[model samples]
Target: MKIVTLDAGTLPVELIKPDYCESWVYRASTTEHELLSVLDNAEVVITNKVPLRRAVLEKLPSLRFICIAATGYDCVDIDYCRERGIAISNVPGYSTRSVSEGVIASLFALRRNFNEYVRAARTEWSDSDHFCLHKSPLKDVQDATLGIIGRGEIGGAVARLAKGLGMRVLFGERPGQSVTREGYTAFNETLRSCDVLTLHCPLTPETREIINRRTLSQMKPGAMIINTARGPLINEEDLADALISGRIGGAALDVLCKEPPAKNNKLISLPHSNLIITPHIAWASETGVNNLIKGINYNLAGYFGGKVKNSVI
Candidate 1:
C-alpha cells in the first residue's frame, strides 16, 4: 500500500523511519494543484498543517484514509470526505503536558509582571534608589480563582497544576448548557469571577471568538487571559482593545488569526506591558512532538490493517 505524507517536516525527524510503513513518500510542500498528482496512487495520506478540502480530495480516487497530525481537523472537509467513503483520523491528547506547562508559564509571567521585572533588573535602575526595582507590582497566585474553559485532558492537567498551587479551580460550562460538574459555573459567570482564565477548547462554530468584546466586557477588570488553543477561538482585535482599555488585565496567546502575521497587526502593535503573544509554540515541545509522531504511526498501522482508530469522521 502506498502512504504519502504531504508535510512530514512538521513531525520529528526520528519518527519518519522506513520501518513504520511498507511504502512512503514524503514532501515538505504540497500545493493544492500538486496534491492530487502527488497522492493519486496512494492509499493513505498524512498531513499536519495542510488543508484537504473537497476540491483536492475529489481528484484522488484511490485515497482511502487521512491521518491528521493534530487533534483538530478543521482544515479538512469532514462531511465531504464521509460522502466519498474516506476515513479520517486525528491525533489527540498528545500535547496535554506541553500545553499545561505553557499555561502555567503564561499565568506566572502575567501575575508576577515578570517581563517588566526582568527588564528593570537588567538595567541600572536599582543603583538609583531601593534594593529592588519596584516598577511593576507583583501579585501572588495563591488563593486566586482559575477559570478553565474546556475540561479535556489539557484543561484537566492545567487544573491539577493550579490546585497544587493553592488556586481555587472553576470549570466553565458550555453556553446554553447546564453546569453538570460539582464546581462548574456558568460560562460568563466563571469569566467574571476568575482572576485568570485559560482556554483549551477546540475552535468549533460555537467556540469561535469565545473571547470577544462582549465576553471581555464581562471579565474582572484585572483578569488575565491565556489561550494556547486555536487562533480564531479569540477575536484578536477585540482582545487587543480589551488590553488597551484595561477591561482585562492582560492576555498571553500562543496562536494568532494569522500565523506570523504581517508587520502591522494590531495585536503586535498593542504596546501594553500586560499583553504577551508568543508565536504559537505551546505545542512545539520536543516531548509533545514525539508523542504526536507515535499517534500518527498508530493510526497509520490501524488504517492499513483494515481497522480504524481515532476516527473523527
Candidate 2:
C-alpha cells in the first residue's frame, strides 16, 4: 500500500522509519496543488495540521485512510470522509503528561511571580536594595482552591499534581449528574471560588468562549487562569480586557486564537508581567512526539491487517 505523510517534519525523526510501513513517502511541506500530485495513488495520508476539507478530499479517490497526528480532528472533514468510506484515526492521550506538566509550570509562574523576580535579580534591581525587595508578590498554593474545568485524563492528571502541592482541587460537576468525587463542585460555584482555574476541556459549541467577561467577573479577585487546551475556549479579547482591567489577576495561555497572532493583536502589546503567552508548544515535548508516532504506526499496522484502532470515523 502506498502511504504519503504531508508535513512529516512535525513528527519526531525517529518515529518515521522506512521499516514502519511497506511503502512510504514523506514530505516536509505540501502545497494545495502539490497535494493532488503527491496523494494521487496514496492509500493512507498522515497529517498534523493540514486542512483536509471536502474540496481537497474529493480529489483523492484512492485514499482509504487518514491518520491524524493529533487527537483533535477539526482539520479534517469527517462527514465527507465518511460518505466516501474513508476511515479517520487520531492519536490520543499521547500528550496528556506533556500538557499537564505545562499547566503546572504556567500556574507556578503566575502564582509565584517567577518571571518578575528573575528579571529583578538579573537587572541588578535586587542588589540595589539593602534588603530583598518583593517587587512582585508571591502567593502560597497551600489551602488554595484549584478549579478544573474538565475532569478527563489531562485534567485528572493536573488535579493529582495540585493535590501534591497541597492545594484543594475542585472539578466541574456535570449537569444532571451527581458530584461523586469529594473534589467536585457545581461548575458555577467552582468558578466563583477557585483561586486558580485551569481548563482542559475540548472546544465545543457549549465550551466556546467559556471564559468571557461575565465569567471573568465571577472569578475570585486576583485569580489566575491557565489554558493548555484549544484557543477558542476562551475569548481572546475578553481575556486581554480582564488582564488590563485586573478583573482576574493574570492568565497564561499555550494556545491563541491565531497560532502566531495577527500583527495588530492587542494581546501582543499588553503588559508582559500580567500575562504569559506561549506558541502552542505544550504538546510538542520529545517524549509526547515519540508516543504519537508509535500510535500512528500501531493504527497503520492495524488497518493493513484488517483490524483498526483509534478510528474516529
Best by TM-score: 1
Please give the CA lDDT of all the candidate structures. Answer: 0.87, 0.84
Candidate with maximal lDDT = 1
Tens-digit per-residue lDDT, 83-187, candidate 1:
999999999999988999999999999999877777767775758577666766788998999999999899999999999999999999987688777767999
Candidate 2, clashing residue pairs?
none
Q: Write the per-residue lDDT of candidate 2 for residues 117-231, one digit (tens) a residue.
A: 8888888664675667677678888788899998888999999998999998989875336677776798778888999999988777788888888888889888999999888
Candidate 1 backbone collisions, by pair: none
Note the clash tally of each candidate. 0, 0
TM-scores for every predicted model? 0.93, 0.90
